[model samples]
Target chain A: MQSIGIDDILDMESRKRAAFINCLSGAKATNLIGTQDKQGRTNLSIMSSAFHVGATPPLMGLIIRPDPVPRHTLHNILETGYYTLNHVNQDILSAAHQTSARYDKDESEFGATGLTSQFVANIPAPFVAESAIKLGLKLVHHQELAVNKTHLVIGEIQTVLLPEDAVADDGHLAITEHGSVAVTGLDTYHELQPIARFKYAKVGQPVELLGE
Target chain B: MQSIGIDDILDMESRKRAAFINCLSGAKATNLIGTQDKQGRTNLSIMSSAFHVGATPPLMGLIIRPDPVPRHTLHNILETGYYTLNHVNQDILSAAHQTSARYDKDESEFGATGLTSQFVANIPAPFVAESAIKLGLKLVHHQELAVNKTHLVIGEIQTVLLPEDAVADDGHLAITEHGSVAVTGLDTYHELQPIARFKYAKVGQPVELLGE
Candidate 1:
């Protein structure tokens, strides 16, 4: 085996970058668009780095960078303990992406993006009406990553909004059929499509071998 | 606007459970299984739920359930100030998943899981040998997701390991080709193929135009 040092590890120019991008290439779930902070100040950002964390507590997480400028949402959430996570479906993918454009702290991305919002009880955050899955997130915890620039926000889902048709009879999420998008870094969208399905336990093994 | 209450949200039923199971359908990325305790007894669990939070501080997070019997890694991470986040590549996927099996407290999952252990300087946790990316994480905060059943553990990455070849000259991550796999709840793996690529600025847009 080749032994390498840390400095050596960091300095080498990579040869596999393109292939690496290709391998993990996925469409950003465009369904969740206009997420807002508790104090009612909002900023638009695009994300493809988001995914599920737990189900029993119905929890999910978002990794956010330090705001480019002072903003109310992050501060509001830290102080008020509530926020909303909205899905960006196909129709609103563009509007959702537009939210990420730098805006004045006092401006609402909802107005610029032209999306509607609703409120949940006990939670002060608002949900986007256009999303296929709307979640009222109760701020549970937040941690600053080592990079010193990102914060991992963990939220306990107090409530969820699902378009009845978006959930299949078997309880599997069919959000893509209604046009959910996936985000990569900040702004890239892909129309999600169901390539195949597998039993939960069948992971680690190939799908075809599992025999449906 | 159609109003819906949190009570109307469906509980975890068999079919609904399966719907969630199905959502893992094609999403795949390899994650480093982490095991650590307050006492500093660390084991490795290589699974992927690890996803990006946002780029501001550039955060990433993952989920872990109580051990099938008594939790060790999760328990240690909660008790101790730190744990290690390792990545599994195509090379270590089998070994990575094997770490999930039950083992005695002293029997390191690294031994059982077919992974080689390498520790980062000044940190107590270990990283996986085959991963293109590995991170050392410090427990920043956690919250009870369910009353007592599940706790969402959030950590800030204190150190990061990225393959020299996985990053582009432009500083963007080109990850898919490095052979990463993603998890649903547990035990599902899929090979990913990149269908397209986009500039960093265009990630979360509506699908109507992007898709066409």
Candidate 2:
């Protein structure tokens, strides 16, 4: 294994290093399009760096910067504790991408992007009507990482929405049948195809060559 | 708003419905993945369904179930107070998914999947060499979420490893370049892509609109 000194590591700039680490970390390839409220008005942001945290209570999380500068969605969710995670497919990818714009507070990205909002049950937040799959989240905790200027928004899932046909009997979801595109690195996006699925097996013991 | 009875809401068997509503109520999706002992014997489970309990010390967490399930990653890190977040990517997506299996103590998924191991300074546990990015972490606090069922593993990042080219001049990471994937519901994976980048702007309210 190649060993490098910690002093050599700290020399790298934070943001520049964050971008590089994000790529190698495989977290750069996300498209977690979301809609949140600002005083009852809605705003959208396309977050592509989200992943699962647990499954028992079914939790999920994503990191958000303080707008790189305080934005509406961050403000709304933190204050009200509610938001929606809408999946971006080929149909809404462009509009979903456009949702990342720096629009004014009264502005609605749903209106600007031409995506429809579907009201979730008992929640004021609306899900993207165009999303292939959408998950509603309630903010349980928020933390600012001192190591980096990033906000980790954690939520327990309340409702999960998926195209009926996409769900397999064995509980696997086939998202690609609907044609979803994922962010690969920084500027690139790619459509996904299922390579293979294997039975759940225990990890096997390593075989050692005895008479070599 | 379309109001549905709580009982009616509970009647839905769809994972989306449950995940969305439960999340909307207050849960945030966040976690940390941990590795095993000094010998790099075990690759444990994921943690931190509780995203941020504290910001001053930069705390992150994960909720892990007890054994008979064989979560080596969680056991090793908690015992040694060290682990690494091996960001899941397309290259090792299958292997990362496989790690969730109920493997035996003698088995090593790292070997089975052909993923290499690397070390970070001062941490006994090893990081995934094939990982596009890895964060070396030190356990800050470990607590039980509920009785006898789950655990909340919290940690502070001590060091980070990133690829050389993934960092950007403006401090933005183009992680999708490394082909990362995000999980949803219970066991579904999606690829990621970056469509566009937007400016982070501040918000202003009009008193006239709210009659303030």
Candidate 3:
């Protein structure tokens, strides 16, 4: 076993520490955020920090890093107050990962990566035509973390587009069935193999495992 | 293909909507957050909302639901200012999921679920003895999501314990090598199948694929 303390983490090189600490929280969902500046030029960037905020109003939260790195996606989301989240499946994994490259503001990632961007229902943001599952959200909450200045942006789900068959009768979205992959650290992608699904958990009672 | 709008989502039953919308953000890391009240009674709860906040100071964030749900984990963190996040692996998957059950205030989930509680380095919280990877963090930043009152708790990593061999030479942690799994929606846990790791993405340069 290995034991590392705070001093050990802080003493390491920046990128190495980033990689070490990044994987500590475990696997994260990889999504390509689609946004467009006020002038309408589009931007696409990949993020692994998206998390469920709540369900009643269907809110999702994303953490955007502060300056020094590219801020196009965060910029466009704040500029337009709307953005799209497109799941990065095997079909577009490489292209989706390429969206993280630092591109000039004048260039659109769609054109750079050869991925098509489709405008749907007048959402003012583009959706990855190759993505299996897509989400259209309106920025409903934004606040900066005092600890790091990274932005915690929460959005309300306005639209969700996915294959009808992928949605089970009980409303469980069969994401892995549609090729959606999970990400770890900063750049590794993994395929998800279904284990079993359990029914709503209750105290002292065994949870009934269900099939996908 | 299915297209769900906000109105459609709001019209569905609460639990169904929860299942539907929870999958939108993609798979999340399932972790056992261990904390203890001021009186030293330990509490352990399963959480899927943990996300990487940043790496410079080594911060991780967890979104805790407001009142209605059991918040013993959140309450203990607030009360003691320290908590431990232990990765959920196959060995403890069922026991980990079982921790979500509503337990008596005096009953520790660790005892009820048969998971061992091991206190390390005077952190004021217990670490899951069975977790392959564990972290001790101090509460650093916290705020409520004005949208739904769900609290966003950020903690700084103070200590880390893991198997030495799971770390790659380039600093990426090979989590799947340690039996860690990812979770979708609420109760579905999936095994991670190694796909490939990509080098740091760069504009116009073809990213190099690295093997685990």
Candidate 4:
């Protein structure tokens, strides 16, 4: 086994350190966050930091780095109070990744990446038309972390759109079945293969695999 | 496409809703968060919410559900200010998932699940001995969400331990190469297969896949 202390980690080159630290937590869900600026220009950016926050209210949270310069996604979400999270499937990986580039606030990533943006049922934000699973979220909370300048943005799920067959009878949406990709670090993509699904665990009993 | 509205989602049964909402976000990194209570009782619990928070200072955050009952993992981290996040590989997936079972405070998950507890440099918390990658973290900041009762616990990486072969020359860790598992919903586990790695994106330039 090899070990690295804090001092060693702090000394690595910035980009290398970023890659190391980002991949350390392992594979993350890849999504393109779509928000519309106050002037109604759409902005789409690749985000792997989004995580499920709760279930009852159907909340999700994503982390945004410090605003040294203007962050169009954060600005748009704040201005409109609504955004969409669109899962990045294999077909759109490159376009989704390209959205991370520092484009001007006036530039729309939808046009830049060649990904179609579609507005649904009067939602102010646009969803990536290529996404297999799309979520409409209304901003509910935002907190700036004092440790780092990153902000945690929480949103309540208002709508879900997906292919009917993607959802199972038990309510699990098989993501890989729809070709969605998981990401590691900043640029590596992974294909997911379901290994096993177990029933809810119980003390003093061995877990029963769902199909078994 | 089928669409589900907020009212429809809120009307579903709790467990089904949890499963549906959890899997909707896609694959998540699976980890065992290890902490020790003040009385020296070690607690290990499976967590899928861990996400990379930042890189310069090297921070990671995980969500802890509302503690209506005593959450041993949350209690221990709050009491001691230190915890370990250990990656769950295929070798230890069953044991790792078993840690989710409700066990008595005095009964260590390590003993119950047959996973070894390892202490490195007296970090106060234990790491899963079978894990190929482990991190020792010091709690830096914690915030309670008003929308949901969940708490976002942030930690700074103090020490990192990994197998020498797992890290690339450029600092990206090939987690799938280490057999770590990605999880979805409550009980589904997935094996990861690296698809592609691209260089950092730049506006107006096509991303160059690494090694292409």
Q: Against the correct fold, how does model 3 do in TM-score?
A: 0.97
Over 4 Å off in model 2, which ranges?
A: A1-10, A27-39, A54-56, A140-152, A184-187, A203-212, B1-34, B38-70, B85-99, B106-122, B127-135, B140-212
Choose 1 or 3, whichever is better by lDDT.
Answer: 3
The sequence of per-residue lDDT tens digits that candidate 3 reaches over residues B26-87 is 98998999999999999999999999999999999999998675688889999999999999
Compared with the true structure, the alpha-carbon lDDT of candidate 3 equals 0.90
Residue runs of model 3 more than 4 Å from their true location after superposition: none
TM-score of each: 0.65, 0.68, 0.97, 0.98
Quote the positional error of residue B111 for candidate 3 in Å.
0.8
Stretches > 4 Å off in candidate 4: none
How far is B113's C-alpha from truth in model 2 (Å)?
A: 6.1
lDDT of 2 by residue, A34-91 (tens): 5556457877777764555544455666767654545777788887788887766777
lDDT tens per residue, model 2, B70-187: 5676678767888777666667655665565556667665665566767667877767777665667688766553323456566765665667654445545555566555543344
Candidate 1: give the TM-score of chain A.
0.75
> Fnat of each prediction?
0.14, 0.14, 0.79, 0.77
- Residue-level lDDT of model 1, residues A1-212, one tens digit each, is 22223344345444232222322322233334234554556544444545565554455566655756764556666777777766666576566666655666667767766877666566676677777666667777677655455666667666656666555455555555545545443343344333333443222342241245
lDDT for position B212 in model 2: 22
Question: How would you encode candidate 3's per-residue C-alpha lDDT over A1-212 as one tens digit per residue?
Answer: 78889998899888889998899999899999999999999998999999999998899999999989679988899999999999999988888888888899999999999999988885999999999899999999898878999998999999999987787777789888889899999988999998878776678787668742
Question: Ranking by TM-score, best first?
Answer: 4, 3, 2, 1
CAPRI class assigned to model 4:
high
Better of 2 and 3 by TM-score: 3
